[model samples]
Target: MILSLIVAHTRNFTIGRDGGMPWHLPADLAHFKKTTMGSPVLMGRKTYESIGRPLPGRLNIVITGSPKPSDNATLRYVKTAEEAVKAAEEAGAKELFVIGGGSIYRQFIDRADRLYITLIDADIEGDTTFPEYDVRDYGIIASEHFSANEKNAYDMDFITYEKIKK
Candidate 1:
């Protein structure tokens, strides 16, 4: 299975606060949609609860210890991260997008082959964060920087990193 992290991180790698994302960047949202559309997205129970619903246009695989989904909206549920990855692969998914909170991100980071990161240029006071990874282990394959105007008031960069062979 090829796991990949899809996240928007702040300057300090902050991901969220109070369950919702700390910032809103249309460009980043668009980038996320473009990349993860039609693929299987695996997330933890807490991450699913945060979103309150499965995202459209993708196979939503929610991982929880209970092994069942609270609602019928989720595409599938798995007890372990390995099962989640397998389910997606069995469903003919070419890429597994790990959309996450801290725990899920950490659980799958080592399994990830690529990283799609949206770097937010701001000092955010957030409680959740993306997992730390060594930049030297991955090469920045692509990057697109954007500056938000008065309506948005923040600058961000859409970056994609591919793991380098050691």
Candidate 2:
């Protein structure tokens, strides 16, 4: 299965503040929903809690060191990234989207085959940030720039990158 990392980060790589995102971008949210609607999405436990519920129409896999019973049928809790990937494979996923809250992003960056990144056009303060990776390793497959509007807090670019084959 293809492992894809999907994230929306500030220019400085800031992804979260406290337990939630520091900015609100409805357009980005819509973009995310459209992109991963049918795919299985894996996120860290904290990321799952921040959203407060399982995202409908998709399998939600939460990676936590402490596994617990998930009341939602669409939600599954796993202890490690390996289990998360295995869960996706078991579900017959063609691609797994790694949706995150910092730590989870770090665990799978090197293994990621594709990156769906939303680059917020402003610098924002946050306690958690995305890991640094060599962009040269991935070639851009698509990109579109969106100017900030009433609905979106900042200008952004939706970019998709696929890892360069060796």
Candidate 3:
């Protein structure tokens, strides 16, 4: 399975605050949904709790120390990032999206084959942040710049990066 990470972060790398995203960007949300529509998504327990439910049309694998039973067919639990990846592969996922808070990203960033990043051009204050990564590790595949709008509060760039072969 191809491991990919999808994230939206501020210029300062802030991803969340008070257990939720700091900005309201509908376009980014739509982009996220569209990109991960048919793929399995792996996330940490805190990220799962923040979403509060399984995403439709995709497998939702939550990595946590404590596993939980789920009646929701799309939702499942795993003990570690490796287990999450294994589950996605077992589910026949061609592309696995690692949608995260922080620690989860750190755990799988090195293993990620691709990155779909929304770079918000604002220094929003937040307690939770995206992990700092070396851009030299990946090559930009595509990029789209969007100006700030009434709903999107800040200008943002949607970028896709493919891991550079060693």
Candidate 4:
């Protein structure tokens, strides 16, 4: 199975503040929905709660030490990152997206096969951050630049990086 990490972060790598994203970027949200629509998304319990509900059109796999009951058909629970991956694969996911809160990203960064990153051009304050990794390990496959619009607060670049074949 192919595993991918999809995230949007500021130049400082800030991902969240006070359990939610600090900026408003409708285009980024749309890109996220389009990219992970039919796939399985693996996220930490905190990330899941931040969303407050199951995301429609995708399998929502939440990793937590304490399992929570969910009547939502789209929701599932796992205790570890490996379990999350195995569950997604067993569910016939060819590609799994690791959508985050910092610790989850840190846990899967080394194992990710692809990265879909939106590089925001503004510095924002945040208590949560994206994990730092060596860019040398991946090669850029595609990138598109977007200017700030009414809905998107900052100029950003949507970049796709594939793991470099050794």
Best by lDDT: 2
Clashes of 4: 0
Order the candidates by lDDT, highest first: 2, 4, 3, 1
Residue 126: error of model 1 in Å?
A: 1.2
Deviation in Å, model 3, residue 28 alpha carbon: 0.5
* Model 3 vs. true fold: TM: 0.97
- Model 1: ten consecutive residues of lowest lDDT: 66-75
Output the lDDT of residue 34, model 4: 92
Please report, as a residue range, the 10-residue window in candidate 3 with the lowest summed lDDT: 80-89
> Which stretches of candidate 2 lie above 4 Å from their native place?
none
> What's the CA error at residue 19 for candidate 2, in Å?
0.8
Better candidate number, 1 or 3, judged by TM-score:
3
Give the Cα lDDT of each candidate.
0.87, 0.93, 0.92, 0.92
**Total clashes for model 2:** 0
In model 4, pairs of residues that clash are none
Q: Per-residue lDDT for 30 in model 3?
A: 93
Cand. 1 Cα-lDDT: 0.87
lDDT of 4 by residue, 56-151 (tens): 999999999997777877899989887898889888999999999899999999889999999999899999999887789999999999999888
Please write out the lDDT profile of model 1 over residues 39-146, one tens digit for every residue.
Answer: 999998899988888899898998898876546544788999879888898889888999997889999888789999988888898899888889889999999989
Q: How close is candidate 1 to the true structure, as a TM-score?
A: 0.93
